[model samples]
Target: MRNLLLKLSPFFLLLALFYHPVNAQNDSIKILSYNIWNGFDWGKDLDRKNKMTEWLKEVDADVIGFQELNDFTPEKLDAWAKEFGHEYSILLKEDGYPIGITSKQPIQLKTKMLGGLWHGMLHVKTYGIDFIVVHLSPHDWAFRRKEAEIISDYTQKSVLMEENSKLMVLGDFNSQSPFDVNYDAQNTFSLKRKQLSDSLRRAKNGPDAYQNLRFGSIDYSVISKFLSLPLIDVVQKKQADHNKKSFPTLVLGNNLSKSEFEKNQQRIDYILVSPNLENQLIHAEIINQGTPDILSDHYPVQATFKYIPGK
Candidate 1:
């Protein structure tokens, strides 16, 4: 019947294509976004990579978005995905660190540059859904904001064309929500501004001026842009109308030189979906569990959605 329809006409062929299901699963689907520090090599031990494999197996997500993958060859990642029971994979094959997407189901590549920005942005179609994986700028908020604008404009155009397609953008944004400023008046907001200002001055004053420099916030722009699109942030949406303190995806250790100089614990990782998929969202969370302890400075974030295969 499908072959016959294909021979009929282009219009009928389109109908025949639409009749087929877009995804394999008919029920719940799990997606995860993780920044494994410097790929799986952060700890400089093979055991760290082994632990990550075991952890991914345990999480059992159908799709995963990974960032900060250093020294990862296609063959290595392919072998890793096979261990996790995923047959499909794609990586941003380029210099410096890159991002990737791995899925249990088949996927087709859409875009890799997201308007030709730094770090990387990936677009893939799989599981009857569209996934955009990204690792935004980490050091400068201004750069991140610019990158976010590129993504926002591209997303707006893409979403308008296929309004009903389930879309998810997930990865290590290295950014935080501007709305959190409401609760960060004293600690988060003021301190970060001071630090940024000091750093700017230090740059002008030469190396000696950076002697007392400290890290500060610069991720607000990306989150703000996504929110403006009215995209549904899995965790944020779940916490709406409640005491909304976002769980920290990036955890710091006690090895810092001074307590005051320590960077604030914040959630810079996220999994956001289009507004159309809001109701399909089951739940989302940041995974920080382990027997000894989870490896990597950034925890993995997961989101579950009720599958609605494309007709």
Candidate 2:
């Protein structure tokens, strides 16, 4: 009877650890991705920074992924994180522009791959989840696609090894979803019309414009490549209303002086997570209440997720 009891003790201990209340709440977290428009022109954004500070406190995010942080020194970023009450920070600075991550919990910086990538991509582990924050090429779709391939390959390899590790990819992709091609056709066509030179127009939609504008036709599949994996866009998949029309993160045309932008918008920023993490998604939102110029060209995107331990 004593020997049998000893064997059962091990099983019971395992159950106790698995069902502990402490472990239950450790996995739930809130994440935010914001493109602060760190530097569109060569001016300063001191007032904007203050507004951002207020915004950050309002969001109360556990983890934050920031992109287009042009000209932020390590010290400045560190201070910014501290001001927001985050205990950990990782900054990837490149040629004055920097991308970064801040977490209230401890962060284990993983291997930083794809060095020399135009904007940058950051990989880290926090709250028992792996994260890849990226700000891909904003100008070229082809380049963005290649970058996505590299990121996808890395994610796939990670999954191959762990199989069920929670992963989240968040940032400003600067591209559109392939699924929304039909909705974007009108906007693409109009943009193309304005881009044609007089000589080019005489040629009547010449091959150069067509080739250069080919990306528009495809609706920019950069995000699609990443989504092809087991990952799902938290807002897109859960928020059915936003599926039909693209929600513009970055606003363009007019309202610049007054810190506003035209109503026409584009949904380029995103937060994507593994299927398991997707199941835990509570809510996702794009924050765009403040004046555009003072707040940011791109709105901040936030998502709430709860971790599911052991699959």
Candidate 3:
């Protein structure tokens, strides 16, 4: 089917869509998505943020996508991010599931993807791409489809008409991908096809491939393509929400085995991203500052990106 589609869809293929650099000079930017496990721990909040600080110093990650802001407002988030040298932070208006965006550079509010129950999509225009850092719920695939549909309509003109406009929809896409589950009993559509759009599937090497998060070997840490607006994921680095190897064996227990870790553990965080500035790709991955005691249960994912590329 893939071969047939590749042949038939070649003409319809988004060949002209990968916007060429209209200008000889180009600027670069980096954006990151993370679930920071933020909460009101009262007196120990400073120490709680230590892992975040350590990761920022090491990874040099500029823009961050954060979930679980607890009760922190945008102002409070900014103040807290500042401890790690992050200059700006924006928390969405969602109740408990607030998502935050932090950057070393100034973040300008562009627009928002208003539909869907998964928090909200933060529309930010930078590096010639309309970047939307999202946090999708794991509740069900129906919500995921709604999220995709909303984004599709939002970028239809700019991204679909081969305008070279880029749109990146990334976050903790809570649901397992299509193939990750058997065919939904009621839905006749191929489980994978129903959830992720065609553009996302084609970004990588294979059709049946899913972002190899959690249970797998390290491959290219993304599903990116130059032509499409929702180009690809940044899984090319074998990245995850947090690192387990950084944990101490003693804390896990005296008698831990491979099966024990696999069953009891999971890398449940993500840092998926779209293409932008190469220099901004300083380093992206889970921050392992040793024990899980001081660190947020889920490590704060980090990446160092410059304000703009070639600056």
Candidate 4:
């Protein structure tokens, strides 16, 4: 009878191990999204890189999504990430302006879609959460909208497959959100953008550029798609009334006048999370304080979430 009971105890232990929840304790995680301005101005100016690396370490995000990794190799990114204590890293591609993801935890590459989109999309999973990092088209509104559709379609299917999926879609969107009232009220940015678009068009197609140019200064189509996925814009969710513009920092140099800054100021970077993780968000903010412009053209965005690791 004792021998039989001993064998049954081993089976019971195995069952318990299988049924028990993994890392059930609630933990918190920090995620950062930054464009890094053409890979810290195309990897020139070592001082800037050092400063950026120090800032990254200070922020100590669990996962970071970077855009404009212009000339970085996989090993280069990995080395840079290691300086900030992130051991794992992945780059979408080698050529053009590549995007990359770095994490303290092991990152599982889920998808890498670049053919149809301008900058491309990278889907990676870490710490029991799926993160889709994107840098959409910056040149045209219609092209950006199309890119948004591709991202939304994929995310929609992912959401459908797992109702309680903990996910985040974040990066340099390069488009305005409807929720930002500042953009709606201010015509300075819109006018400037339209003028820039028209100039580019004219350059490409001679004087007949007006025929092909359609600039919706305050376009919502790109951002609205992600919102329709029911993903919460962390900035809006946290600071509903505060106007936080994420671009055109001191990268244009510290000499810009107040009016010039205002004209270029806009929120082009974002960190959007799935509804399932919305309630878990602790805080979100644009990292604009203290020489942010020197590090990159766009300020880095950080969000903290209550997470259950290995879930």
Clashes of each: 0, 3, 19, 0
lDDT for model 4, please: 0.81
Clashes of 1: 0
- Model 4 lDDT tens row, 98-129: 99999987889999999789989999898888
Question: Which of 1 and 2 is ahead in TM-score?
Answer: 1
lDDT of each: 0.71, 0.69, 0.49, 0.81
Model 1 residue 106 distance off true place after TM-score fit, in angstroms: 0.5
Q: Where does candidate 3 have its weakest 10-residue lDDT segment?
A: 218-227
Q: Across residues 1-311, which tens digit of lDDT does each residue of candidate 3 receive?
A: 98988787866666644332322333334455555554534225765566556755565444667766777776778787887767666777646667767766566677655456567777765444455666665433345556655655665554445443444555555533221122122222222332444335446646454432222221111211221343433433544423322222223433556444333333334444445433245555545445433445444444434433321
Clashing pairs in 1: none
Taking the tens digit of each residue's C-alpha lDDT, what string does model 1 give over 196-216?
Answer: 776786689864553212244
Candidate with top TM-score is 4
What is the Å distance of residue 229 in model 3 from its true position?
5.5
Best by lDDT: 4
TM of each candidate vs. truth: 0.78, 0.76, 0.57, 0.86
